[model samples]
Target: MPMDSVMGRARALWEGLAQVPVSFAPPGGVDVVVSPRSGLCPDGWVGVVALGGSAIVTAPSDGIAVLVRDALRRLPVEAVTDGALVRQVLPVARVLGPAALSYVSPAGFRAVEAGASSVERLSAAHPDMRRLERSAGYEDAGEAALDEITSPAFVVREHDRVIAAAGYRAWPGRTAHISVLTAPEARGRGLARVTGSLAVAHALAVGMLPQWRARRPDSLRVAAALGFEEMGFQLSVEVEGLSPDFSDAG
Candidate 1:
């Protein structure tokens, strides 16, 4: 996978979340591709394009920096309530739940998306699903993927169950990060393999390529099986706190 592909997927991931009605989604900020497209911001935006990474991006005539300036100008997070956590905390802003699990699907992977339809499929037999059941992320959430799978043109299921899982964050363009584990019982049965293939197919159908992180050979095999090529090693760049640069970031 080329870096561009990974970054594009990252943008798609964030955009997908942001596209929902503010009243129906998480409180995270939108994805921004900035620049010098050069030095990255240490703080991550939409899980793509870390501010200070060594990407060596050349600022084009319409470099991402301009887009950042324009977007921030319009959003004016300053005008919005200054919540330390999410981008907007104003009483007027739509209240959304904290999010867990991020995954992307190929444009037409409806079959894969469909596979996760039944939350019940996650029964006691599924290992990953079972683990998810215990996770702080999904406690009582009741099949988080149920909503995402049902919504967004895509769907992700745990084995046959629809478990909302966030994954495969393609930081800047195409490489994605996936860290979802199903109930311990669901492991080894190859549910993730099937679902991941579906996602890769869907992404490819729409020209959004997919790739597996080479670090984990097993996971990489899943991607490779779905036509995903290795793109070399990957690095994780997260934006947790407000970097000093954005004392105004709050």
Candidate 2:
């Protein structure tokens, strides 16, 4: 029921963001928190003011709009719902539980510190990274660009090709978190494990904490194996559609 409502909100948000840029470019925007929805929205959702794509409901706010705000709070990326009735409305997506916001300190963040990295370091990206990309559904964090302002990125390569990657993003007082994804065609090759470990371990070494998502069972395992402790849990709520307002012109 919650998923259904979030699905509807997602559709609505997508419609709102239809003309806006949700995903940030390497050199784009100031930070992840731009104020189209306002407050706490940036920490969870990864897109711009226009709401599109999938979302997670982290908390059950007093109002339904809070679902959208909560979805933007997830570290593991999810669609947490407040109740079953929420889902009854959307009917397109479902509640995928919540993600634990597990983190490792920079002292223990040692995944990438292990060996020679085949991952290329680029400021902006070339078309090659897209080829290395497996799924078009999820977006990627440009480590090369993030490195310019945040943490560095390392990846695995095959046949001189960069196939997988992992890196971190900073949030003011903290050096913050990391993300890793493998090319779908290149699954089961230990690339995610390797990249994940390196990314978290390095974060620990730098006095920064390594916080990744424990959304799926495998996510918990991979992050835990790298010394990331389970910080707790994060809830997500997705809205398939909502009546997004856009009448202001200030």
Candidate 3:
């Protein structure tokens, strides 16, 4: 996708995370989106842009009809209510678990600078990796994913122990998705935010947009504090079991 298109997609994703009603008019048509804070599809709603495409929506039956109509512009559109909307729309879409999408522009990110006296670049060989592996707030897969990262990774330490770490995985176009983990005992100390800021700074320095996805409210709060705008929430469900992806009554 073109850079503008890529940015637009990122913006839409962030708007979804914000869980607010939105109307986006792109080239050919407009997308009427909504992210209901509660009830069905608690994650969010995304409308299909094509004339005969499918949209993944999470709303009451009545609201679904209005959103679908506005989004498809009277075109034949399929409304899928399942949480696994990504997998339904794009078979190749990876299951990323429950997450909220957020993003920060370079200019906006300048306001969230953090200072970490002992932050250091991380590598597979870093001894702190062992501590991160054992931390309850982190997962082995997250540590392993570090190997595939094309952007920067950092860790904050207190003496000899790792307190928090932040990193990003390269994504399509000029965006990089960020991930951060803080030791359970290190919570509320701002280690995650400080380390995360370092990672964001490095990403912006390299001309990459920073994208934040998190399922936890605390994580989302930190992202918001760092100038990341909430776009939407992402939820996934099993694809093998379901009926026709439409419901007028919800």
Candidate 4:
């Protein structure tokens, strides 16, 4: 299938701009491709898509792509893009499936809308750090926000407690993946959008493209408010359970 037909417009834009290679699988063998391009694996992951007797695989290196190609052989074609099955096979991988939505901001674009005036940049030493740690959204985020607190994090304070927050998980290359959190009691208050705007502004200021991934409609709404355009869904498989290090594979 054409890359545009399979990956959608937004993905094609950046992927084309990055000049990443696109390959079609041959019969009885894996497509086996590796690219360091940030757009292909924005979250530092590898992705494989198997459908209709063809497979498309992307990895940081040829060795990993080969490993994923081999693994894909043991699975049904449907499993190639199945985030759940891929995760089971590669427990260390992060998988994104059709259920996930990917969004990206245009170059030279900054959030023009204003966020909450009460927003404050946060750090590990912030007094509300302890409370933020206990929030449902933070826990659901895999506690990445805690590690990223030293990075560009913004939050909204309510009575000396942080009620919502947003920050970047990692800045790999020129792409920065953003994560947002809002306390359960603070939901529906637009705090996420407010703090998220601050995070996006910070990313743009530093010359990094902001990326947003949302698994729910509510989160998508927040991204839309920040002027993020939906690109496509991403499915990735972790390299866990395999040899801890596959970097040197020949």
Candidate 5:
């Protein structure tokens, strides 16, 4: 697909996910809206997404939305997505991320040639997947969000155990949101890249735009190695008086 077309689809995906009517069109700035139906987050939460210098802010209630809009309306997309700036604006907010948003097109992807024969495709809900997540502990597993994926999991095993895994969940506008996890002891073995490569390839095969939302440096490196282009950033905040229920995050 052409670059413009790919980006158009990406914009549509995020707009749909916002749940409140919004757009990524030009005049590059933020659009703050209050919506109880926001797919970006649940009620009492705040989601800020910036793409190509344009942004959208979704808040759970009118008061919260008004507060955020008054504070961030004058800032550029880059600053709106900045954790420090956001914290300064809302002094008592708990920020979840300023995750780097990346996208891979068929023309931009660089697939890895894997020689690891232990890699196998399995269901994302397989018992072994649970074992792998447990081995990695709750924090890492949750960061990777592997359990939340809907696609087939591409996993690498060592000594009859799943050491690394990758997959993508179907998102709006036919986009694939990639997720990857590796066992604690299996770091630096390139297993993540191999499994991630497989996952990206599969998403591209089905003509879905692949998106990588990375919070860690290592995850960003993997996305870059696979030729995913960093396009923007996303930040989710829990305001001072509004408690965000994270039960749905998993």
Candidate 6:
């Protein structure tokens, strides 16, 4: 698909996720909305997603909405998604992320040509997939989001052990949320890029928009190398004393 079309789909996805009736923020500006839905975060927190040239903040209540709006009013759109800036502006009890949000168009994706020769594609339900996750442990496995994938797993094995793997989950707007994990011992071997390439190829074949949400430098670099453009950021902040007001939530 064309880059513009991909971008339009992305906007719609975020709008639906935000549960707002507006386009994303304008250049250098922020748009705040209040609803019961928590966009990208858990309940009683703020979810901020910045895309294109604008940013959107979803709050659980009108009161929290005002707090976010007032706090972010003077900042540029870019700063709105900055975790540190956001934490400083509000009474943040915790922050989930300020992860890099990237997407690739079929026309822009640069597929890896030969390195993934040893990869094997299997059902996500395959038990070895979970074994790989266990091997990677909590942090690496969670960051890869391997547990959430709904697509076929592309894996690399060593002595019958799954050492690296990648896949994606179907998301709204026909988007594919890509996930990749490489065992600690398998690091620095480019296994991630290889397995990830296979998974991305599968998503593109099925006409899904591939998205890479990464917080680590290595993961970000892998996305960039695979032709994904970093267009935005996603930050979820937990505010002190914030509680859901279901009376007006939608």
Q: Candidate 4 lDDT, tens digit per residue, 107-165?
A: 42336343444876777456575577677654455633545543556877888888777
What TM-score do all the candidates reach, one by one?
0.35, 0.52, 0.59, 0.60, 0.92, 0.94
Task: Give the clashing pairs for model 3.
Answer: 14-230, 14-231, 15-231, 16-231, 16-232, 17-231, 17-232, 18-230, 18-231
Alpha-carbon lDDT of model 3? 0.56
lDDT of 3 at 96: 40
lDDT of 2 by residue, 92-173 (tens): 2434334455555444444534355455543314455555553423343332223332555567777777666666666433
Better of 3 and 4 by TM-score: 4
Residue lDDT tens for model 6, 89-191: 7888889889999999988998875453477887887899888889889888878878789998998888899888999999988899999999889898888
Candidate 4: which stretches are off by over 4 Å?
1-31, 34-46, 49-103, 106-117, 124-127, 143-146, 238-250
Regions more than 4 Å wrong, model 2:
1-39, 42-97, 106-120, 124-126, 134-149, 238-250
Candidate 1 structure lDDT: 0.34
Candidate 5: residue 246 Cα off by (Å): 20
Q: List the pairs of residues colliding in candidate 5.
A: none
Checking candidate 4 for backbone clashes, the offending pairs are 92-240, 93-238, 96-235
Is candidate 1 or 6 superior in lDDT? 6
Q: lDDT score of model 4?
A: 0.61
Q: What is the C-alpha lDDT profile of model 1 across 1-250, one tens digit per residue?
A: 4445454454444334332211111222322333222222222232221111111111112333333334334443322112223233211122222222223345313233334334222322335544455652563324223222211222245455544333333333443333333444455555555555544554455454443433344544544445443322212222333232332322
Please give the range of 10 consecutive residues that has the lowest summed lDDT in model 4: 1-10
How close to the true structure is residue 78 of candidate 6, measured as C-alpha lDDT? 83
User: Model 6: how far is 102 from its true place, Å?
Assistant: 0.5
Over 4 Å off in model 6, which ranges? 114-117, 246-250
**All candidates' lDDT scores?**
0.34, 0.44, 0.56, 0.61, 0.85, 0.84
Count the clashes in each prediction: 46, 58, 9, 3, 0, 0
lDDT of 3 by residue, 178-198 (tens): 877777877898877787888
Q: Candidate 1 or 4, higher TM-score?
A: 4
Assess the local accuracy of residue 129 in candidate 1 as a C-alpha lDDT between 0 and 100. 43
